[model samples]
Target chain A: MRTSFKPLAAGVGGVAAALLLWQAASGARAAGGSLPSVGSVATDLGALAGSPDFWSALAQTVGIALLGLAASGLGGIVVGILVGSFEPVRYATRAALEFLKPIPPIVILPLVVLILGPTGQMSWFLVFLGCLLPIVMQTVDGVHSTDPVARDTARSYGMKPVEILVRIVLPSAMPYIGTAMRVSAPAALIITVVAGLLGGGPGLGQSLYLAQAGGDYPTLYALVIVLGILGLLFQLGTRVAERRLLHWHESYREVAH
Target chain B: MDKLMNKRPVLWLLGIGTPALLLAAWWLASAGSTDTFFPPLADIVDRFRALWLFDHFGSDVLVSLRNLVLGYAIAALAAVAVGFVTALAAPVRWAVDPLIHFLRGIPPVALVPIFISLMGFGPEMRVASIALAAFFPTFIATVDGLRAVDRGLLDVAQVYRLSRRDRVVAVLLPAASPQIFSGLQVSLQTAFVVMIASEMLGPSRGIGAMTLLAQQSFMISDMWSGILLLGVIGFAANFLFDLVRRKVLAWYIGSRRLARAS
Candidate 1:
């Protein structure tokens, strides 16, 4: 207990020191005085916390991200299973998936923004695209990696194909799906933010851009802090959710021991 | 069963056929297009040929590439340097761990506004944003890689009375290179995305800026062509990075292959 407490105390001290350093730097005119003092930014953040507009913008961003992820999660798992179960389809799509996987979502940002007119729809579509391929790929890998021996044994036992799929394949693939979702969640949020920042779409990103344009440095700085904290929450949320969902898996079981 | 997939000819056919078929279908479908937003692929190709063949190539494409490469290089070097010190010093690690994790969570694109606020709309702003955004992944990877180095190997170096520089160069770096390279790949991707975001938000000079401008002005074909160029560049950059990673890590891969075989 004492040993663990030391690290926690050190972490808190570190954060305090960083705040102090930022305050000093701002006073010293770091980056030619554009940097806002930490105190002023925090005060502005407090003000923003009470604004209805700020809450709505935050909702828009979070809504786009969650809806995008949920859609992609459902679509990817279904498609991945269908493709992975069939040899021909898997081979046929492998090359195309590889080619498309590395292309960043930003490549299509302009086209979507143009078509959708910088709406929440545009942000949602971009986030969906950004998160879809990875989930599909991971799910496919998970399905493909199911133990052949278990499958063969099930076949010899005269188990129905549907039964085997439900009893064996899905359980085996759960960990992979969990991991893919964990990675995709943050990516979904980031894409939504980019849609706002660059495409004039609706979200906190647009708010940040407006503040910067208005020379509301305090508000801009405050919004950035909000975004940073929001991002941290998304990451932590997914990680905890993954662990909880995969508690029955061997990796977590070993940790329990 | 899966043998058909292993044949070189089948692999090549699928690889070449899929993209060609998709493009052919798109071309046919969009032909005689009346929709203002959806231009025919033929017109897009023509615009792509004119605008990107050499016209805006120097002005936009090269500028974006220069910024990306320079920023990525700066980030990779700085992260590795800082990572070494942080990994070696317990006090530094304790102080920085929570802060690092928090900063890493902030999406790279979100940093652009802060940078724009500081530096305004300039080339320096773009590069600075790209570099800072690209730094975290490599820094975390480097620290992990260095810390995970085998204690036995360090002991061996100590017994051999090796100089500190030699110990790091010979014993530490090669062992850590694989993880570092993976982090570099992520950093490059982050840098590329941030590069596009910064340009789109800015002084309007690079490929991204031009692309956004063309779309806003309703030059639909030109916009399509810009999107096409970006896709191609993104694909090519990844392919090139993979080639480099493969060449650099050939020895590590060979050993792993041997271990698996045994």
Candidate 2:
């Protein structure tokens, strides 16, 4: 429960030690191959920061991820609410959803490429499909977890289905929605990169794949570092949003901090 | 009459209707397009039958599944062992947490080229890639499961003077099973995804490679068939996991049912 400095220090130390080992291994490999030293990778990382291509790719990656996430978030919430509310709908749809949900959308890249022609459009489609099911399922679970009393009361008050959904159901499901967003955000990024790698789009993923193919260790390492940073940023942002939005929820309450 | 009116068929219709409608719309929209991109639904189905089922596309599916299972099993075993040791020791947990987080944050796909360069174009490299993909989720889940064990339960064990091994096996393992199972579900999904991606990039035998080959040959329908097969496999894995979960965690399911009834 406690986030003490000692544990933090220990965790950092562990990471450093792992990196040290990696560096040593790379050094040994350097004798026979083009292994970039840690310092050289750091320099490449700095150079990447200033490069127009890197910035463009970063922009493209972030743009696709955000767009796909937005689409999924909106579509998922709507479909999830519909599924959660109507029992007949839920019963009828459960099997189909189960059948469809687990299928990795990444496998359809070639199909998407065939249809959409390996464009940014295909990239967006891939990322959107990758993140959709999780977000939708989480939203449905959230909606289902809402207080039975509140739902009944709204029904008794002659609240229209749409009204109850927007006012009563959605508000209650915010926590779950937030959690879904947090989970899906990383997924969106990863899928976007994968799309780029496979479809030859201008993103961090494509750059990394190209660098790897070109055997540019320094650039590959640099790109990997950047990807890690982006992931960290997403996690931190999600935590901040979750705390601010769901402060009243029991799950978000600080433990006498 | 009212009871008959509320039959399961009505429920089934409700669920299938929307997706069916969607598919119909898709078929209609793409009906006129003779382009390779928008192959009609009928064409895809025909292709699916010819390429995947009737023509015996078993080798590709088997290869991918074999890699997925072997890699996931290895990763699950190793991660569970390492995660348990770390969980049992606060020092180890603290020491390794950051490293785990760092590695986990880096998407497994990013490591494909590295694995290829290191291990070359072989099953070993594919297995390693899948293992890397599976390891983090399982490790994190195991740690979470261990941490989430009720302290009061541990206290009870201590009062009963249970051996450390007994405490872990009897008390901790059952309590952690749900979380561990969730991790397994996630790891399995991840392994399959990574398997396809790795094969697409490097190898020549799995579903991913088949998709790539179909693309290169301009066999759009064959590519669609491969994609459809992958989807079916993914769905089957998830459905099977759910069935296993129901059986293994019957107590959990029973409790839920009781709560709902009350």
Q: Which candidate wins on TM-score?
A: 1
lDDT tens digits, residue span A1-96, model 1: 987887788888999999999999899998899899998998999999999999999999999999999999999999999988875667678887
TM-score of each model's chain B: 0.94, 0.89
Please write out the lDDT profile of model 2 over residues B1-262, one tens digit for every residue: 8886778777778777877887789889877669866677778888888776655467777778889889999999988888789899998999997777777887778777677767666888899999988988988999999999999999999999999899989998888888988998889888888898888885468878887788878987778777878888888887887999889999977987999899
- CA deviation > 4 Å runs, candidate 1: A1-13, A255-257, B1-12
Candidate 2: true interface contacts recovered: 0.61
Docking class of 1: medium
Query: What tens-digit string does per-residue lDDT give for candidate 1 at B86-154?
Result: 987877888899999889989899999888989888889889999999999999999999999999999
The C-alpha lDDT values of all candidates are 0.90, 0.83
True contacts kept of each: 0.64, 0.61
Off by over 4 Å in 2: A1-5, A30-35, A144-148, A155-162, A249-257, B1-9, B16-35, B40-46, B53-59, B259-262
Can you give the lDDT of residue A217 in candidate 2? 80
Candidate 1 yields a Cα-based lDDT of 0.90
